[model samples]
Target: MQTVGEVGERAMIALFTAAAAERSDNADDVVIGSGDDAAVLAAGGPVVVSTDTAVAGRHFRFDWSAPEQIGARAVVQSAADIAAMGGALTGLVVSIGCPPATPVDRVLALNEGMVRQTHRLGGRVLGGDLVSAPVVVLTVTSLGSLADLAPVTLSGARAGDVLAVSGPLGGAAAGLAVLSAIEHGADPGLAHRFSALVDRYRLPQPDLTQGPIAARAGAHAMTDVSDGLVEEITTMAGASGLAVDVDSAAVPRPDGLDALAAELGVDPVRWALSGGEDHELLATFAPGDVPPGWTVIGAVGDAGGGPTVDAQPVGDLHGWQSFSET
Candidate 1:
């Protein structure tokens, strides 16, 4: 297999751009596509843009996940920001930096993964830059539009609003724990028994459509659970100038999470509350106006204590912090 150095930067750019163009759907919103100086997009209203970066060793490992999975994960986490704001994905600009010794096929597969995911979420790969670096780094800039709806923000929640989540939680965190255990020489059978959790950690399939649905249902505030449930709610409560009461029993959990947690001697609820990377939308809506697919887990109240689950103060449970050494 040829390395990226063998293909040269110019040829690699051509290859990546071609791959993105082929997978992109014909959309009226995209005026200029890949291989351009900059992408031109037709917007119906204010454009909602977001960017996320994934670094090798930190965000992913080649031995643990395929190039395709890594690529897909990048798009999912990036586009989720658009969804959290009650917008639909329009296009993406992905910048890739990797060592010259990286396999050419790996980079191409990564592009394919991104394009396929973008297409799946109603977006196109517009343009990006490819550079040589010491390790693989993927930066995905996602563009979106809210059409006729107003953009949902973090400070919109009011007292009496109901708090809900779009989908299951803790799966990603649990999956990470399982993968870490396996990497450290745990029984390989654990992989087969907990494949679902493993898959969740590798490639999270968050429902981006729920953001718009929540907005239409009159969500007051919304944010994605990239860090963890407890942390996100704490942020929302602080931003909204109100307190949130989370009913621990109401947060959804992935199937087999209990069993796996038991096997690992960990608390499943802890994982659900503090696990990050699920990318599920956490929003506050008017009571009874909660959308069909969302589960009501709590309610907004007057500010006092920060946030609580089961009416108890949220003490030690926390989410992923980028700067923290823990």
Candidate 2:
């Protein structure tokens, strides 16, 4: 086993998990698998289930993201995912893996984060398990109940639907750029410029409340902006075999984004178009207008169609994928 910051927390957990995956028993009563936050059953009333994760090197860094931040972020993100399905969270569970040499306080800090985030989202931790690993990994699962039978789906976008987004864009992209530059040994002054954006990326302001609002507002299709806008728009368009047209000039820029873009030698538009992990909600509506906190960005044109900025093609329809190099 490597000792003392020899490897990132995520790598250690993956190694240990790989070893553990082989030790599974056939008799374990897993109503669901070991991926999402909470498992499900026929104890059913249309439960909303979601899973979120924080890795040592990828999702967060111990040197940057505090232990509590990791826990809170995991819970918030999982809760956001459930809310995307128009479900209100009822409970949370964390499956935590940590190095043996890790400080116990850090673990407590992690749990504290979950509790804080759970309270923020109006939920609580039911129970969970602790395990030994080489690095720190947190996986939070959340369960919610659907008020109505209507569940928002990304694949249900319809042509002529209004394409809209809740909250600002380019912020998370700005933040992630900071983290990546820091990892590459950038100067502290430059990294600090991305602090807010980075925090937004690490602790996303998932539009949990807005999801149901959109669902209730005759939303034809809906999803969170976990991926970049164009990528997500393309995802919905492709799912419905429809085409999307976006007005690049219409997207609202977050504060400090233009300055940050100039500092990083990037286009604010590129960040908005191709950025990922913002977790803002992107929904399609056939109604005449937008709900609160939403901005009109474009319209759905045809099936298998793509976005047009001022009637021009946006960036390549593909957004950044986690395992793929951008």
Across 1-326, the per-residue lDDT of candidate 1 in tens digits comes to: 99999989899999888887776556777788888788888887799999999999888899888899999999999999999999999898999999999999999999889989999999999999999999999999999989899999999998888999999999999988888898889888887899999899999999999988988889889999999999998999788779898998889999999999999899999999999999999999889899988899999998665688898888988888876675
- Tens digits of per-residue lDDT, candidate 2, 282-321, equal 8888858578789999888875565566667664645767
TM-score of each: 0.98, 0.82
| Reference-based lDDT, residue 159, model 1 | 89
> Which candidate number maximizes lDDT?
1
Can you tell me which runs of candidate 2 are displaced by over 4 Å? Answer: 1-44, 183-185, 191-194, 306-317
Model 1 TM-score, 2 decimals: 0.98
Candidate 1 residue pairs in backbone clash? none
Model 1 misplaced regions, further than 4 Å: none
